[model samples]
Target: MATSTNGAPSMFSKSNYTWMLIGAVVIALGMFLMSGGKSADPNVFNRDAVYSTTRITVAPIIIFIGLAIEIYAIFKRSSPEKK
Candidate 1:
């Protein structure tokens, strides 16, 4: 059981950090999917682009899944051996 310089023990295990990183990436991907609904011509409105299924439904679902992952990571217990 290695300790930090402060010697208070680490708060998170390797797996927790890995899960957190994965969740962050998923959230970022969701945000990316929800982006870019701009029209090439400023005078014209692109209804389909703004209201696409990917942006409206899939993106939100992905974002929620990412959030759930993050919550799980935070509450996840580390193995006794790892500690």
Candidate 2:
């Protein structure tokens, strides 16, 4: 639904920007998940907290998903504006 009136075509549509925003939010959520795992005592290390499935496995997956979304956003082509 976006065609530049002038000769040049717009690089991205509103939909593309929306997807990019979603992707960025997903990435931030993944980072937030990875950032946690603080132990109560600094000296004593809690292996479980450090190696939890959410941090090691899930977060990276989430981040990758976000990256994929970002890639999609970048590559997505705008549909031709209907008459």
lDDT at position 72, candidate 2: 100
Cα lDDT, all candidates = 0.91, 0.92
lDDT of 2 by residue, 1-83 (tens): 57567967778898899999999999999999999778888999999999999999999999999999999998998888778
Q: Point to the candidate with the largest TM-score.
A: 1
| Backbone atom clashes (below 3 Å) for every candidate | 0, 0
Candidate 1: Cα lDDT at 62: 99
Clashing pairs in 2: none
By summed lDDT, which 10 consecutive residues of candidate 1 come out lowest?
1-10
Residue pairs with clashing backbones, model 1: none
